[model samples]
Target: MTRAFLRPDDARDLVAEQFGADRRLTALDRLAGGSKKGVYRLRLDDETTAILYVWATGENYWPPSPTVPDDPFTDASGAELFATNHAALAAAGVRIPRLLMLDRDNRHLDADVALVEDVGAVTLERLMEHDPAAAATPLSMLGDALRRMHTTLSPKYGKLAAITRGEAPQTRRTEDVIVDRALGHLDAAATRDARLANAHDRIAGHVRLLRSTVTARETYGLVHGELGPDHILVTPAGEPVVIDFEGLAYFDVEWEHAWLRMRFGDAYPVLRPVDLDPHRLELYRYAQVLSLIEGPLRIADTDFPGRQWMLDLAEWNITKALAVV
Candidate 1:
């Protein structure tokens, strides 16, 4: 009876323009697990489907933070960023959903919307849940896709949208960014939870201690800033198509692997992350843990329906942070 985001009819004109005037939108179901944007599956009269991404203010549940949007690690949203990363990845031979339409001019909807080919409901996460053995092939395929993405090098380390548009390159070293961002998260989390506050200095020292062991690099690789089984979709034929390219950027591959290790857990080794820098991985792993803490807590502060899940995530990561000290 009530609607927080765009209704099915709200997107009627937009869908019609994309699929032609004859194709009618039968339904638009908002999928779960999106905190920064509204992800909807649009079913058509012809029994076809497409995914619509709407960057509306009502859709984002992340509470405002000190970090600016330009930061490589900040909230990755907006249609321009999506278009830029999509083009970069698609050009790099990554198998992602085909972009059907992009309405940046707001010709159809008041918000910036993009319509992409529907890869289906079988996420790599879902497939693995049904049968871990069957996920082996998809995991291996994901490893290959990640390799291709990581091999796509960039001279500058930052969001593809910023660097490619002639903006000044991110001059600071990757390690510097990691340390600063982690400290920022530490400070934020401390304000909310007394446990993090008590262990702040100790955990901060641990982060810096790990950072001290890292060396600088001359180049960076393209990475799906957040790569997890959930971010990947498996086609019926067993092909892996990665989604959520908004955070796609050229950065330390270890940063990507740290996230991969966390999300993939025991299934991580299947990706075969070889020749990685241990020092970078360790430091990034700690930083990533802090991020998981702050991110969930921030989202939970809003009207997110998964408030309990977010708090639990922050609590779990809090234990993780305190344990290492």
Candidate 2:
């Protein structure tokens, strides 16, 4: 029989155990937007509220693919690592949720879960969508928050595990990790779509040019691997609080900025003083499209909502990237 992952009653029991025995879970409402985790808002009888996040494991979660190999992180230790990163980011003056408890052993749930403070914040994506013109303050705050995060330096480049283990992480070279992943994706795309063969050749040349012009920087820092507007939250007080540290890594700050630029237009100014090359930035932007394409490719057969839209967007972005290259 399939095991039930998480239900309201289970959440209530967990909350009761963490809070006093008399404390009761008055309400359990599932929040939306995470692809790999179940997020919920819990209200207690004492009128306090908290957010519960349950991570999916095994095949339920996306596995490493040729286009995006080297999965440096796992959900087994996600709660603990998230808490650690939260503390580090908070100390660096970046606003984030306070992790209350980590359920690693599945003592109260079927999978790994994290209980954190609910700050009553809205996602930056929603804010931007509501009023693009009024998003200036939050956008500026987001830039500042990213700058603060980058200040938390790492000794090496590539994955967070290597840095955390006190070992030198993977280094960047001309045929760096991103290039390899891009090539893999292009190969797959060409096999599925013959029309992409010419575009693949163009992208290959562009990758070579990108590597020739860009070199690894002396400084490496905490980079939010996925820094889309959706991951940022704007509190009721107009403060920007960054969330979702699972994809965090120790890599070039330029990659993070590149993601931000791809999500938000080029007009978004860089708040930090890191040297950025236009070509490198464009290459990273193209790489982001390649990474995005992996998702639709992985689930092409499934009945995923907006699958067509996702594929279309990937193709459109690929065309845009190729045009620039």
Candidate 3:
């Protein structure tokens, strides 16, 4: 059975411990777009607010074990992922919401929780829709910040937590991992859609063919695996701060740009890296679409709050996937 979200009273002591006894939680509202973890906005009596992240089984919408346990892209959630990636991003000079408190011991909440500065409700996606001209500066800033992150190299390619703890799996070619994930997504997508099932062989062949064209590369850079405009928070001062860093890893910059291109659409040109391998971009783009198709369909199977939206996303991407092959 699904559990209920935390209530204001439930987190009052937690807020008091970190913030102060004088600051009381007046309201606790669960924000939208948090599928992996619970994101709540806590309003205090002092007219201030903070964001809370709860990493618990109840909060996650995706399957408990969606993919191979060791896969770098497998279920990038949890306090450790957030904390490790947060530290890595800060050290790399990337701007993220300031962390106020982290509860790994589950002292107050039954789950691992983190409290961070609330950067307001406006996301870069919403800002672009409402005021394109006003969004230009923050978008540019986001581009520059992303470029910096994409160029920050790591000795090995893996999740930041694993890399930092020196427990990263044996190094493999970036292309190999990409192809494997894409193929895996394709296999899963095939079972649900008749069109994908019919074209499964053709699509799989195309993916492998694309993989063969890529050359070997030694350098890998830090990348946010799930960077979308919705994940970027625009401050009142018009500065852009990126959120959702749990999927942080060292990977091919082309892979990152491919996702950027898909999510940003025409605006992607503003954030595009000048030196991306076209071959890698093509392969990754197709793979990313396949993932978009598979992941949403997987999530839609559950009683997620966004079930219809997830199904719609899968439907749209299935069309995109068919056009590719």
- Clashes per candidate (backbone, < 3 Å): 0, 0, 0
Off by over 4 Å in 1: 1-3, 68-70
Count steric clashes of candidate 1. Answer: 0
Ranking by lDDT: 1, 3, 2
Give each model a TM-score: 0.96, 0.86, 0.97
Rate residue 283 of model 2 by lDDT. 68
Positional deviation of residue 223's Cα in model 2 after best superposition, in angstroms: 1.1
Model 2 earns a TM-score of: 0.86
Question: What are the per-residue Cα lDDT tens digits for candidate 3 across 18-108?
Answer: 8889887889999888888999999988899999999988888787524644567776888999999999899888889999989999899
What C-alpha lDDT, on a 0 to 100 scale, does residue 170 get in candidate 1?
A: 63
Where model 2 places Cα greater than 4 Å from the true spot, the runs are 1-5, 58-64, 67-77, 132-134, 171-175, 270-273, 303-306
Candidate 2 pairs with clashing backbones: none
Pairs that clash in candidate 3: none
Which ten contiguous residues of candidate 3 have the minimum total lDDT?
64-73
How many clashes would you count in candidate 2? 0
